[model samples]
Target chain A: MNHKDKQIQSAVQRALGDKGLSRRDFLRLSGGGALLAGAATSGLLYPGTARAVSTNARIVIVGAGAAGLSCATRLNRELEGAQITLIDRREDHYYQPGLTLVATGVWNTAKTLDSNRRYVPSGVNWIHDMVAEYDPDNNRVITDDGRTVEYDYLMVTTGLQVNYDQVEGMSEELIGQRGVGCVYDKPELAERTWRAVDEFVDNGGVGLFTRPRGDIKCAGAPLKVTMLTESRMKERGTRDKAEMHYLPPGASLFSQPDADDFLSKNFPERGIQIHWDHPLTAIDPDAKTATFDTPLGDETLDYDFIHVVPPMSAPDSLRESELAAQEAPFKGWLEVDRHTLQHNRYANVFGAGDINGVPIGKTAASVKSQVPVAVENMIQAIQGRENSASYDGYTSCPLITELGKAILVEFDYDLKMKPSFPVISPYEEHWVPWVMKDRLLLAAYRAMLRGRI
Target chain B: MAFSFVGILAVVLEFFRGWFWLLIPLIVLDLVLLGLFFKRTSGRRRKFSLPFKASIGFGVFTFVMALITLPGITRSSWEMLAGAVDYLSLIGASVGFGVLFAILAFPVMLHMLGIGPKHKPESQATRQSPAPETETGAEAEPSTASQQPQG
Candidate 1:
């Protein structure tokens, strides 16, 4: 190995504490790097051979996000002679859940953004293109560049598309104005949001945070921003100077009962006014005002700062496909049986994470529970055995009520409370949960996403 | 006969004890109450609109089948379902209780608060479309050029 490689290995060994590059880890890193380099250089691994010896059955995965990468990792481990290809439009993969912390100045933007190629498991092919058409009948998907790839199995994890156009008189251009920002969009924009918040504080203006209607990736993120922003202002001694408003489309602070009580009671003390059942309808950037459709009536509020959480929906590729038209409520967010995490139509196909149409809250914690279930079911199906493994619909929401206190709400399939650690009660906000949120969750998230867990 | 068989098995499991007598009447009362609830509620119609209706139907079907085929299955199934109901009711009671406490504790009436104004939709027709390209190879920028300030 080269000197630089030696240094990296040494550092990794030190970091991992005597694990000393397991055979699995070495193969994964080297194979993944070689495949990426090969793809970039020659478009194919071997010049003369049509297919590599390592790849037998072709597996296609849509989206290079958390779910797609996790699925690819599991498939690589389970199916040894399998050709896996992951396709995504973007060059960078983002840790989307961290955007909440980024908006509140708790995390830097660079921490959340990483190269998409860094996470793809070894022996998997990377196709950097948006899917143009999904023809499930023939078991093939066409790319925007007119390249058609046939696959024995297809896993769709495109998650959600941000619909910024839904708000009247609001365009993408309106962002980063006077004090306008959104944590739900691009992770890179989060730093700019912090700057906007800082400016809002300096200018003695009202900070308005909004939550739009429909299914967002992390439902608690908007409130996270609200609480963190309030805490930041208190630290800055600007709490009394600037007003804060949290406008949400939902009737309550949180979908979980325990979380809702904590937020409703504690938020008022922080001088945060919550406009429940109020959804952002329009934004007058020039006038520095935002209009919302409240349950009572329509209201336009003047604000120095505006942070919008855009309405999200299933990815267009999945929505337009024939698989989506099958018996389901929404489009084909992968028609996986909730328990088995296996596609109802095609047994080979499986899904995990936010893309699944389960009623559970879409969070990183939800993906942690889903990965094991998907892997178990996928392995069983591959071995021609009965797939008895089931997902419990487990999800967690760490509601950061303040800088030092958080209410960790965990629940299962039936919305039954499932706390990870025994606390006084699941509803009570405590400092230990907050510490877990700030310190341990990142390590857990990285490990879980890498499928080490 | 299936119900009697399951009931008899329950009686057997209870050691043919007098406690089994109480269970029989309770089971009958539960079945009667469930039937009454279904009959009185508008949700009994087969033309259900919600997505959860199918799952509910499947759960009920499984319960009925288990009760008919095996007494043990019926007892276990009933216990599990009852446990789920108990948990759900506890959460519901907590929320309901909290709401009641909030209402009673707060002096200000909820109805007294003034309603906020409504949001009006803008006219889309008058909104300017993208500008046409110029001959000088310069793209004409929009009239309202609001550049985002760099951090």
Candidate 2:
């Protein structure tokens, strides 16, 4: 190594030494790292049918986020002689899971920031534009730039949209000021959110953490930000100075039965008053007031800080398209079969990632699981065969209870706890899950981009 | 992004205060592991063990990750460090921080202990070897028909 490299390496070693890790701990993690690496490379940890099916079909994918990138990468690998195109206007990719850490001040925004160029595969044609309209009947999409792209098959993975404007008197600009924070959207927003959260935790006042009902990405993030802020208050010796409240849009805080029960009990112990069925309707940032549409009536609460989680749905173009579900329950969401992820009416069209109107799993872990099923099924479609692969609504949310502790809540369609690590309990907070979030989860997310797991 | 000593303490305290039922066992296990580290490292032949090497690698990795994550928190923003939850937080965050600290620092400590990868001279030869031939890269043999007298 060069002198500069050696110096950098030396500085890192010194920093690690300062942190107080001993030789034994290194040995343990070495063993753990080996297992992780082995599991990843062995094709057993997250295995799927990974062979190329030769075809001359043109496949078009919408969006370039986690779901889009993952789907495109896997499709590139699994299909030979196929023209695959990924369409999205975004150039930089943000690791959305790390946004919670960014907002909570556990990690910097860089942990959540990356370039799409790194994840987009070699053979796939990347179109740096967005779809203006979806012509599903004709198997073509018109772009905002006025390009008409025809495809034999289509995959929509556009993710979700956070409607801050839905909340009256609130905009993206209001964050990081007036004790307002929302841990969604861009990395910059999460960073701005930390500023508001920091001021609230330090000064000590009424802090309101709210979550919207319906489907949202990483359902655990709002909870994590609240607990982390509370923990920060406890650490700051300002716990007594602040009154905390959690507004769940529904009767329950989480989807999983066990997790909901745990939170219902845990909140009371933490001195947090739960306001069930109170979904945030509007916010007056100037008055530091929030309006919630509760079961009783429209209640307006004054707050020093409010974590605003906006209701999310498919983008307007897709929601307005014929591709969207036309009925109740999953209205305005991508219309796909819950198990197959294939469009109910259109067999050649598939949905991957958050766009699919599934029961649960709007998180990135769902992307990892859903991508394989979608890709395999897409390949089967290309070969004029039956789509045998099915998705069981697998979703993982590493629900952080505190800064360094989290509950790795992995579940399937039945809401049954599926713990990847058998010893780690899904019901209770554990250090391993926290470490996984902070230290390990991103690597897995990236590997999924390469279709390795 | 400093991953402040205080921020780490908050996590420990939160664990104990939030999940108190699961600390003593973890603490005892960490304590035992620390003892083993000392017991193993005190010997003369301590260089280049997996434990030693992994400690260094993990430490380096953590440092790199922290370098990226630390920008999230500034030194001035550590005012929250003043608060403590219960009596358990005092022991929990402290002990927890201690154990986690040891785990993170062990790799660096191992490196500092002069336990680096010892390279054998033969490994240098491996780098100089020619690229392995792929089926396409292999030269085509002369056709028997072409080698026969021209028609």
Candidate 3:
């Protein structure tokens, strides 16, 4: 044997011995790795691949975000000879899921930043401009740069926009200043939020985490930021010094009943107070006070640190367009059937991601499930056949309770717990879910974008 | 998917698919190293046990995965001295990742290392050995295939 080979063998032997990793352990690990690869390949991890259909249909996808890119990849792969164009002005793709981690100082800012160019498949046209107007009636979209692109089929994946202006006296510029933090999609903003959280953790005082009235993407993020901040306070031996308040717009803490039940009790036990029906009306960043419009009356509370989650809705382009739902409940959102994800009025139009007026599932996990159904339904429409796939509004949230623990909350439109791994209870906190969130989810998300399950 | 063993196993497998880029390469490297080790020690030992080889590969993988995931589990300085949550998370994540990756890499390792049944051409077998094949390498081959290697 060569000296180098002998040395490597010797080092490996020493490591095994030091760790007391027996032959059984090795056998188990090897068998386990083999099982994982086998299971993943055998269509157990996700659904099986279907044969690609051929079509010359012009498909224009709005917004190159998670849902848009995923739809592009899926549609590009599934349909042959199709003209697929993705429209979005933003070049930098943000992993919105990791923003919560970054805001909590658990992840670096760079981890959430990626390029859309990397995910946009070849043979697909990418328009480097945002859609200024969605004219579904004419089956055409006008870009911000004055380009009108007509499509045989339209997929609206323009994710919801945070309205910082909704809260009077509050703006995106105010974040990271005067102890105001907003954990949204921006990595820089998340980092700035982390700086504010860090200062709040060290010098503790009244920390208020606010949730707006309307539906927001990743509803768990605000609660997660609150819990994590409190955890950080406890870790820093400053838990007693901080007075944490979670002001939700409604009585329920979460959408799912079991999750809501668990969180409703969990927050109070953590000593973080909850004020129901208190929607954030305004925030005076200079005065360090937040105004909440409560059922009783308008109440202003002073704060040392505030996590501002703005009221969200479909982008102005989509909302102002004729495509938006004019009805009650889902008004100002993309008007699409919740199950089929196809437009109610326009058969050529489909919606996925947060823009859909679904009762639940404004999450990346929902995108994972919704994109396929939407793409399949679009393909079915192009084939002049009935829709074959339907979305159950499946969404997952790795609700981080602390740095080390989280709850794997998975549910559908019915708000019932559909735990993927039945062994891990959906209500209890566990490290497995936390690890999935911190280390593994980005890979899964990227895989989704590539349409590889 | 119901709550069956296979379903749970699949979930665990899907979880590790995210880390496949890093893991596949790691497993391949380990297999290459092990192949070299087996090649060097082949003559001395009567048989290089597959279980032992698998153990060595898995050990290395688990150690590396633990190292990679540990920093995240204990990223905060306060988490170091805070309580049992950080340490417990480290242990759980290490074991979970280790097992999942090991399961995913074992088949890959077996395929790359050619540890299972292999076919050798009759002409090559005749050229390499004069007498009937009696070595460990010969035993690893299919008996039926050995009789008619070319076929």
CA lDDT of each prediction against the hidden true structure: 0.67, 0.78, 0.83
True contacts kept of each: 0.00, 0.00, 0.12
lDDT of 2 by residue, A198-237 (tens): 9988888899999987888888889889988998888789
Residue-level lDDT tens digits of model 1 in A1-453: 999999998787776557666657877988998976664334321111232133366788888777777777667766768778888878887878778777777778876787677667667788889888888778899999999989877777776778888887766666666677877767767777777776776666788889887677888888888887887777688888888888889788777776777788777777888888889998888898899998778899998889887777777777767655354464545577888888777777777777787776578887777877876676666567788888888888878766666677888777777876653247765554564566556555554455544
Candidate 1 on B54-112: residue-level lDDT in tens?
Answer: 33444445444433433122111122222332334334434544443333322221112
Q: lDDT, candidate 1, residue B33? A: 47
Ranking by lDDT: 3, 2, 1
Predicted complex 3: CAPRI docking category: incorrect
Alpha-carbon RMSD to native, per candidate: 33.9, 18.5, 11.2
Better of 1 and 3 by DockQ: 3
Ranking by DockQ: 3, 2, 1
Candidate that scores best on lDDT: 3
Q: Residue by residue across B1-151, what tens digits does model 3's lDDT show?
A: 1235654444456557756799778778877766664665444332334544674579568966685657554453323223354456566657766776666555444545534433346557674433345545533544554455343
DockQ of every candidate structure: 0.01, 0.02, 0.10
Query: How far off is residue A137 in model 3, in Å?
Result: 2.0
Which of the predicted structures, 1 or 2, would earn the higher TM-score when compared with the native?
2
Better of 2 and 3 by lDDT: 3
User: Each model's TM-score?
Assistant: 0.64, 0.70, 0.77
Interface RMSD of 1: 23.1
| lDDT digits (tens) for residues A19-106 of candidate 3 | 9987578779889999777755775544444447888999999999999998988888788888999999899999999999899898
